[model samples]
Target: MEQKLLNSPQSEVNVIDSLFAEMVLDKALLDFRKKKIQQKIDQSLQDRNKREFLRLSEKLKDLS
Candidate 1:
C-alpha cells in the first residue's frame, strides 16, 4: 500500500475512483432491500396480517 502511494498520481486517482464506486454500489443495494421490505410491509397491511407487518416494519427500520 505504501508503495502504491509512492507511485504515480494516476494510481492514486484510480484508487479513489474505485472506492467511490464501491460506495455507490453499496447504497444502491441498501435502497433495493429497503424498498423490497417496504413493499412487503404494505402487502401485509392490506392482508391484515399484524404479525407480518410488525416483522417487516422492524426489518425496514433496521435498514434505515
Candidate 2:
C-alpha cells in the first residue's frame, strides 16, 4: 500500500514534501521576524526610547 502511494501520479509523497517545505519556510520567517524585533529593541535602548523598547520587548516575549 505504501509503495502504491509512492508510485501513483497523484501521490501522498508529493503532498507531504510540499507541506514540509512550507513548514520550513514558515519557521524561517518567524525566526527572522523575531530577530528584526530584537534589533528594534536594541536600537530603542540605544536611543533611550523607553516606551518603545518595552513595547518591542513584549512583542519578543509573545513570539517566544
Candidate 3:
C-alpha cells in the first residue's frame, strides 16, 4: 500500500506545498519588523542611560 501511494504523482501536490512558501515569506517579514522594533528600544535605553549618568555626574560635582 505504501509503495502504491508513493508511486502516485498527485501525492506530491499536497496542502503543505501550497502553504509552505507563503508561511515562510510571512515569517521573514515578521522577523524583520521585530528586529527593527528591538533596535529602536535598545537605542532608547542607551539614550536614557546616558542622560541618567550625566545627571548624576552633575549632582556629584555640585556637592563638591
What lDDT would candidate 1 get against the real structure?
0.92
List model 1 lDDT by residue over 1-64, tens digit each: 4565547898988889999999999999999999999899999999999999999999898889
1 against 3, candidate with superior lDDT: 1
Alpha carbon deviation, residue 43, candidate 3 (Å): 0.5
Order the numbered candidates by TM-score, best leading.
Answer: 1, 2, 3
Residues 7-63, model 2: lDDT tens digits: 686787788899999999999999999999999999999999999999999999999
Q: Which stretches of candidate 1 lie over 4 Å from their true place?
A: 1-6
Looking at model 3, report the run of 10 residues with the lowest lDDT sum: 55-64
The best candidate by TM-score is 1
After superposing candidate 3 on the true structure, give the runs of residues whose Cα lies further than 4 Å from its correct spot: 1-15, 49-64
lDDT tens digits, residue span 1-64, model 3: 4454754666666656768888999889877766665565566567887665555555545534
Q: What lDDT is reached at residue 43 by model 2?
A: 99
Question: Candidate 1 has what TM-score?
Answer: 0.86
